[model samples]
Target: MSVETMTLQEMKFYTGTNPRPEDYEAYWELALVEVASSKTTMEIVPSNLQFSGVQCSELIFSGTDGARIHAKYLRPVTKGKVPVVFLFHGYSGNSGDWCEKLAWIQQGFAVVAMDCRGQAGMSEDKGGVKGTTYSGHIVRGLLDCPNKLLFRQIFLDTAMLVKTVAELTEIDSYRMSVCGGSQGGALALVCAALSPAIKRAVVQYPFLSDYKRIWDLDCRGSAYEELNYFFRSFDPRHEKEEEFFSRLGYIDIQFLMPRVQADILWGIGLRDEACPASSQFAAYNRLCAHKKMVIYPDFGHEVLPGFMDEGMLFLSGVKDS
Candidate 1:
């Protein structure tokens, strides 16, 4: 962890450069309405991937725009309305293998690992945006109306999944939670904000926070490299910089933090250049619910030691039993 990027004191008060749009609350409220209006139906099929004590299945559901979304659902065979956890993946990544998620199942948790739309997964993305879908999802609907932003639909998809999971007779809606790293972490926060049923969230080095801060820090590589690409390819002169960033405010997770009702357990790596410590803090500080942050001073974007164990403890409301 380099003190050169940001001091501990500075990170505590960093309000971030990405200004929240004035209509931020109304925008999300309307977006939620749109998601609610879309009739979502879910289908679950037994999967070949088997675990000793878990039942694995392919969970498919319709998202906003009627795009078919996919997730891997794993539950303990001996279950009676057990707690469930929604697992999101990293940027450009899929839901991951069932074997990797057996730990949670062993802890008596039902896990629904989702593959984000159009990512490296079975999910379908109905692309109808008017702009360049060349590099990343951030700029997918930049040139069109704010409603067309890919994340708007993605965020809605997360909310829709939560709603579907909450309504499941096999799940204890009051005990539902979400967990993920990087882009998945961002979606975890988004899901918690959009779904009041989510009881807890375990987010690690979440992406999609304070876009202008990422630009100012010149730390726009890896998952956020699309920001630089969008600038160079679309607005070379930086003339539409304000408009672009402001439009990006629609999907910025920092602005969505206030809407989160779930208890949050945030993990951050001080040495993370990908998501940046300041950007992570920007969203963490806005959280008004019961929250705790675990800081790994020497870590980067990779996994933090004992994070899964710690996360399970947090979500289970237990102390390493």
Candidate 2:
């Protein structure tokens, strides 16, 4: 049966058809080592949206290649070090305004939301890659060496953000969670996989998984739209499809998830078109850590009702698994 028509029961056991690069593990290990060598410097700018009980600041730090990455840092006016939740935004979005983060702070959790580079945020993108002309991030640097992929750099930024947050005087490095929806959800899982410090990941309908499956299923719209554009404009005949997908496998979340040691609170909207539930299952099923799945059978790519509330309660004890 075609994946599009598969029942939810069938999706539970469906691993995608994406070709994982043989050296996926080694690629990330080497990439992690490369980022570890890069020096990270940070500056805290006073935030204009501060409130009486919460400390809000704009944080800028160096990501891979000295890109100036930006993040919003907020913490409750608490007496001791508090658990923290690292936040990532959706594709083409920024680290949202400070007012929205107050709820986490009010819950006694420190929050750090990073603005992804070259999207709708303050982070910098230092370009030095081949084939950089793509409609969206998925295929940016498609012709470059595996290390030059944009998501590779973004994934590295997630690790760097974790390292930076771990150093804050008011944060309990031993207790940290990561949270997001869509692209944010993917990066949360990416951060959890790459950074050993993360304790729990609250992933909501994650994107960037099982590209081959997405294509075959014709889910070439929304975030996956770029994949369709890349083929029609570049390869045109699926002649080099294997090569492209293998390269993409390096940054694919399913390949990286095995390294994740965090407790996972993964949510899926069964009707999700942008990121098909089968594509998400490709990554989720590989996780060996403590995990819980919250499914919204009637919803699409939109927010999962009550999922965030459930995740917040789950991240309270951010001790790394």
Candidate 3:
């Protein structure tokens, strides 16, 4: 079959080219401690959008560096605690409409969809990095310490969401799950890795993996266009290419896959140009936990057929009869 990336056979073995920082594990450990120490305050205000058998609220909470994160929370009005699902959005996108999240709520699962900080959402991003925030989030803290990497704080935001939700009286923390595509997909994996409470994760064609490989393929548009912008703006001569990509490794999802304990459901499209199949496999290959991958030979970065239904089934933990 014709391929936009590596051949399917090569993809399975692709371990990624992004250099993992030497203190990767330690860096995240300290970040988690910061998240733990933050004085997080949550405010859930009732939303005007009302649906039968479901209660909706606008959730706001403080994240690392005092960023006010926003999410739409929806729960079934039932008495007992129920499963919760965390939903993330694609690059430069928000949590999305309330209607799209109702499916999970209808399935007896409470849903929290996060609007990434400083994106096309209500989440506040207190930008104080040393370099440019002009093009992309990946390059935000490149000129400064790795701890200032935007994704580091974003990943912690997701973990803080999990921790907060787990503490909710109406949530069955043990049954928690997360799902998303592209940038959101990467965050889903990060959330699962950071929070042991996540029982399942569904990610599709995740971005932010195998960065050097993406540069090799020259497929850095769309979600990864920021990589091009960063280099051109900051390191036009490619003099510090290795240094920049290596710093990005600190946020690379492939390096964090091993820490994820949840059963993962990954969808990969072989023809994907936005997020190459090999890049997705780079992270998938490292997962040691129970996992399943659904391959789409002809599909690109677009939706995989029946994946939504499949994901719902996975999150619901119910087999189709």
Candidate 4:
């Protein structure tokens, strides 16, 4: 079922064209320390979206730079502590409807679905770095200081979510996992890497890895259209090509993969154009922890039916990766 531009053999070996910045580790370590030390005011306002056997609440807290981050927290009506799974949505999308998340209650799971900053969600994007934003977040903090990069802050937000959820008395932090597809997939990896609290990750057709490979493969039009827009609008001559990619390297998931302690349950559509299989492999090949890939040869970046159920099983200990 493999229909990739690059043969499955080649894709497995592909390590990516995005260079890892020398200070990448130090930068993230410092950033994590900074966020951990910051006092974030937390509040869980009970949501009116009620359902049987499920209690829904909006978990809002201050992220780095005081951005108001929000997540829909769903806890099943159970006796003792339940396993938790942090859910991240696709780019420009919100934390999905409450009804969809309630399905996790079948496994007695506690779920947290985050709305990324400044997109189509209730989260706030406080970076406000006046720069060349191609109406997309990848380029939002590009022209400003490297530390202001949007994904950097988004990654921080994920770790913060894990930190926030672990404090709840109704959760077993040890059985936690992170799950998503496309942009959500990339974020799942980022969260697992930053917070080893996550034991499993189900990533499908993840975006935001191997940026240079995507550029060279010409797979930059869909989710990555901003890269083209940035080059045409600012670096028309490709003059700062290396400079920009190097900066992006800071947030590239391949660089962060080695730090991921979670056992991976990665799903890839070999025919995916929005997030090419080769680019995804570049990060997949670098993972240090145990991983199992679920390749969908005939599928694209669109929905892979039943993947949701599969992810839930993996997260709930019903299925082993």
Task: Specify the highest-lDDT model's number.
Answer: 1
Q: Estimate, for each residue in 1-321, the C-alpha lDDT of model 3 and write its tens digit.
A: 333556778877879888988998999899888878877689999999989888999998888677778899999999999999999999888888899988898799999999888788888888832222334787888899898888888999999888777888999988999999999999999999999889899999898888898888887677678889888898899999888888999999999999999999888888888888888999999998899899988898898999879989988988431
For candidate 1, give the lDDT: 0.88
TM-score: model 1 vs. ground truth: 0.95
Across 1-321, the per-residue lDDT of candidate 2 in tens digits comes to: 223556778777877778988888888889899778877689999897779898889999988778888899998888889999999999988888788988898789999999888888878878643222333788988898887898999999999988887888899999898999999999999999999889888889898999998988898777788988899999999999999998888878988788889989888888888888898998998887888888887888886778887787778753322
Tens-place lDDT per residue, model 4, 1-321, is 332468889888888888788888899999889768867577999998889888999999878678888899999887899999889998888888998887777778898999898777788778553222234788868898889888889999998888878888899988888999888999999999999889999989999998888888786676799999999999999999999999999988888999999999888888888888998999999999999888888888988878767877887788988
* Each candidate structure's count of clashing pairs: 0, 0, 0, 0
TM-score: model 4 vs. ground truth: 0.95
Candidate 2 vs. truth: CA RMSD? 3.0
**Cα-based TM-score, every candidate:** 0.95, 0.94, 0.95, 0.95
Query: Residue 51 lDDT in model 1?
Result: 76
lDDT of 1 by residue, 1-321 (tens): 442367989889877789778898899999999877877699999998787878899999989778888999999898489999999998888888889988888788999999888778888878732222334898789999989998999999999998887778999888999999999999999999999989899999999999998898888777788888899999999999999999999999999999899988888899988898999999988998989898898998898999878889988889521
Which one wins by lDDT: 1 or 4?
1
Worst 10 residues of 4 by lDDT: 127-136
Flag regions of model 4 displaced more than 4 Å: 1-4, 127-135
Superposed Cα deviation of residue 51, candidate 4 (Å): 0.4
